[model samples]
Target chain A: MTDTTARIPKLTRKGQATRDRILQAAVELIAERGVVGTSTEDVRKAARVSGSQIYHYFDSKQALIRAVITRQADAEPVPGRPMMGALDCFDALRAWADAAIQRQEENGCRGECSLGSLAGELGAADEDSRQDLSNGFLRWQGLLEQSLRAMRDRGDLRPDADLGELSLALLTALQGGTLLTQTMRDIRPLRAALNAALSYIHSFAADQR
Target chain B: MTDTTARIPKLTRKGQATRDRILQAAVELIAERGVVGTSTEDVRKAARVSGSQIYHYFDSKQALIRAVITRQADAEPVPGRPMMGALDCFDALRAWADAAIQRQEENGCRGECSLGSLAGELGAADEDSRQDLSNGFLRWQGLLEQSLRAMRDRGDLRPDADLGELSLALLTALQGGTLLTQTMRDIRPLRAALNAALSYIHSFAADQR
Candidate 1:
């Protein structure tokens, strides 16, 4: 992040809400039309913000895109549970998967995973953007690993199980399942992939945990 | 596909080679710059094709993208053997995973799965494009199922194993792993995901196949 991004001005309460509203609108527009298809004018019109307001909160379109990435990383919880942070237990993990799947369905599988779309389109496009995406994914996997490690400490997982590999595998299944679900517009692949992952994790559980 | 797509012109021997050249060039350009970033003029220059020639073969840019999807679908083989088609036996499946992993490393994970990038960018943008991408995924999955069913008939798999669900799970893992690999620029996640998937598949092998 540049100095400008670092100082994305925090506003007074009213101005902060306006900033958030623009970010949400940008996310929806980009999700619907793709980055190339969306323009600053489109976002300004959608958010009911003036062109100056967009420039005020975001240094440029890339900075705005980065903010969207930050917003997505913050969408970790579903309802009341910590989707990745508390995923050590089976029920918690299952609930997280359920929330992920339900979000895809409820959205009609239309918009890209706010962060995932950036990963695919921007992963290879630029160094800074790719690093941002990589960090986002690692942060997510770290949360998953924390929960799995918690399980291991509780005698829930085998001492021999590789938590690093397991966490990577689960996140991989998720990214792939989410991609397929988005492409095919069917929830089965995500459900199956996660089910297989849950079963694989269960195989490591000590006496069903 | 429109009538124009159905009748994408077949050419004389030299003409066919030129068409192939255009497609290969388009794939590279799009992979590097993205669909919206790449233009027909860029393809014409990259492939050394005349403007008239591009128009003669493809009706529009969307048509060219559709052809790219078809080209990607044809990239299923890892080596001399059919990768997904012969994924019935354990060694064959492992080799296929190894090949997929190697491809990511060899390519420096620069491009999203050609098919997957399109799926994310175009899946929800338009209906016709989504159908084309959906067909591409189903065809790939069908090849997977064929070999899996072959294994079942040969008594390699447990009688009760749900091949349909298993295949879906495997593909899901692959897509997820590939996505992570692309994002993180690390080969470990793809390797881990595929290994987990293969282990999950092995759990259903009769006498470990």
Candidate 2:
């Protein structure tokens, strides 16, 4: 058989830069115009790359979408959380929620979270995209579940409370609340929802001294 | 000014049928391909109508999108108690959740949600569509809040609990959980999340038995 390796082109540093530019432009365009509204030409122009260059980097629009999914999946809300495992109390949970909401709001909900938007826009057509989204959610849920388990072990939460279920509820509430806040272009409702959810969380934890 | 009312074409019986066919096709296409993937030509083929016929009913693609949003806004999950004002207790609240989730599942979580898809797809380009989606969400929240308030009045929930806040949490959980379920293409996670939220609700309510 012919050497299959010969067909694969390796990206040089400059070629990689071009790819990054294309992806960055795509992210912005997707945020502003949505997956359907965004066109390849728009991305090509936005990235300042020629039409040929775009094709060189991505095989198809679907390939570009996969890139977007991977890029967003790797993104985090903040730089540091190395000690996330150390946060084992209800107070820690409340603080985390505050910080998360603040960062999301400061962004003005304009970035249009990649996973959230994907879930809304491409939930039906791309199974691979769906799996990527599922993995992202599961990753987040696992983090929360780990934190909750620590809290339970520390007697911060009720010993019998189902951490998996609790984690899912909290995650779901946060995502849904964000969607509502974005749609209304207001944060008051989100604040109310978060505080209410926090109160529920508190009730499950051991009483504060 | 000349009377312009007569100039507006009224849809005849056959025309109405064609319009409905177009709308139905549009809904299915949008749900599958998102707003970006759907085209007038695509819709024409799905509806088995000529391209000119589509223009006759809708002036442009944006007009068609507006019609879709309006149609979705008017579509509500039935079989629930009339608003939150009439909900007297926890049983009424549970019934509402059941109906909401049932309808959501029956719809197969198509395209995350028609209104949500529109909101995510249109972004800042369509202010009116955004407003429509925002209004629909608010109306939904209002209905839930009214139900929670009735529960509080009936002493079914803690007197100190904020009905408005709780309602927001409930709605957020439902929306987020449904979206997550859609993305995963599995109902177990959604069921778990909802059951957890419901359990939390029960914990907050005053003991009836």
Q: Candidate 2: where are CA atoms >4 Å away? A: A1-18, A48-56, A77-87, A111-113, A207-209, B1-18, B48-53, B77-86, B102-113, B158-160, B196-209
Model 1 achieves a DockQ score of 0.69
- How accurate locally, in lDDT, is each candidate? 0.78, 0.70
- For each candidate in turn, the TM-score is 0.93, 0.82
Record all residue pairs in model 1 with backbone atoms less than 3 Å apart, i.e. clashing.
A176-B176
TM-score of chain B of each: 0.90, 0.74
Considering the two chains of model 2, state its CAPRI-style docking category.
Answer: acceptable
Residue-level lDDT of model 2, residues A73-125, one tens digit each, is: 56643325533344577777777777767866797755374667766777766
Clashing residue pairs in candidate 2, if any? A36-B36, B84-B146, B84-B147
Question: What is the per-residue lDDT of model 1 for residues A1-209, given as tens digits with 9 covering 90 to 100?
Answer: 23223455565788878888888898888888777677788888999998888888876888787777777765662445655878768888888888888988897765564667767666656667777778788887888889999999988898888888889888888887877887788888888888888778878898753
Measured over all alpha carbons after superposition, the RMSD of each candidate to the real structure, in angstroms, is: 2.7, 5.4
Best by DockQ: 1
State the DockQ, from 0 to 1, for candidate 2.
0.47
TM-score of chain A of 2: 0.80
List residue ranges in candidate 1 displaced over 4 A.
A1-6, A77-82, B1-6, B77-82
lDDT of 1 at A54: 82
